[model samples]
Target: MAKHYIDTQSLGRGPQRLAGQARVADLSRLVSDLPAQGDLVVDWSVAGRADSAGRNFVLVQAQGSVVLQCQRCMKPFEWPLDISNEVEVVATEAELELDDDDVEGPDRIFCEGRLDALGLVEDELILSVPYVPRHEVCPGNQPDAAPEDEPPAKRESPFAVLGSLKKP
Candidate 1:
């Protein structure tokens, strides 16, 4: 079982509360290939909870600061991430129905084996990131005209965004 696994025994005893700190550089999957891992850190908490209907669930909350390359400026900018989600627990993977056209219920996760904590938080962090990260306004981009002495900087093609997807 994973070291951070949340087993049924813990849930049976009562609600389980967990919290920790993880450096952004340590979570390879969370910030893959982003420059300047630096001292960025994420504070995360996971709690076993039950809804009003008594259905078992896990409430995952995470707060972190990340650096993302601006799609417009191609420069790095800080983005704050505060994610909280309640995922319903199911007995088996078969209960997860993605094709249901009816009113969708809360997110569902299987309760078999081990429910990895760090992995779950990382997943939520990834989803919290903007599809296309950009700064409100690029640095030095003002209403005033550019100085003539400084040569025009080369601009990256729009496809530059796809560079992150290429195999290293």
Candidate 2:
């Protein structure tokens, strides 16, 4: 499907809702961080709302699965993406700065009239990705497994050598 851009101010005023499916390939920011192979599926929904303080906010929900290279085994693994967030829309950087100290509240986003729904989805997906992706149990051979031809190494303790030198 073609990309969609919404007027942030109008959407916030009406508190509109948007839902769609976007190919993972189309999300450049998300695709760059993932492994080259495999198909990914992304489903997303966004809604506009006004808080009690009359601040414009955007609610986003994005779910999908992408193949990631496991850091442990260096192999591809399927990782699910589920992101749900509500961001207060601010007109200027100063507004965001004012809200920065309010860490306990929802995040704040600065919108310059137009908001890119696809880019928002991509950002959410990227945030959902783990710092290090790995399976609970590796799908292939254990990474630390020793070669079959190599015998396990044995070491003599320093204390044993000292004891031998001080034999009674």
Candidate 3:
């Protein structure tokens, strides 16, 4: 499918809304971080409006699910994605910098007329992913756990071996 691009300037002139679905496979950057197997679904929407202060802002909402490797079990698990963000559109870098100190304000983005909607969705989705993903309770036995029947192998300490080799 052909990609869509938005004119930030036009969005600023009036309120606008957009919604779409993007296959996880199509988002290369986001897909790279996910596991090879399983299907991923991404649904997203955006609403643009001019605030009372005359600042242009876009409200982004996205939901999806992808198979991610569990850090604890070293197995694949389905991870759900849900994200919502309000981004202020700024005309220049200076404007973005000025808003940096406003800790409570919405996030800012610089636009040069056009913006890629798919890229925005992908970025937000990536940010929503957890730093370390794992199931609440592992699905099966822990990988490092020793089997119930056999005793763990015993090995002498390297230091003890070295001491024995040294002259008395």
lDDT per residue, candidate 1, 111-165, as tens digits? 7645778888888898888989988878977567779998888999999989999
Top model number, lDDT: 3
TM-score list, all predictions: 0.75, 0.78, 0.79
Assess the local accuracy of residue 22 in candidate 3 as a C-alpha lDDT between 0 and 100: 79
lDDT of each: 0.79, 0.80, 0.81
For candidate 2, the 10 contiguous residues with the lowest summed lDDT are: 4-13
What is residue 145's positional error in candidate 3, in angstroms? Answer: 17
Worst lDDT run of 10 residues, candidate 3, spans 33-42
How does candidate 3 fare on TM-score? 0.79
lDDT of 2 by residue, 86-122 (tens): 8888889888888467779988888978788778777
Q: Per-residue CA lDDT of candidate 3, range 1-168, in tens?
A: 457676778764788788898777778887796787345668888877877777888788898887789899899988888899989888898888894678998888998677777788788888888889999888876468778898998987878877878887
Please report how far candidate 2 places residue 43 from its true position, in Å: 0.5
User: TM-score of predicted model 1?
Assistant: 0.75
Error of 1 at 88 (Å): 1.0
Per lDDT, what order, best first?
Answer: 3, 2, 1
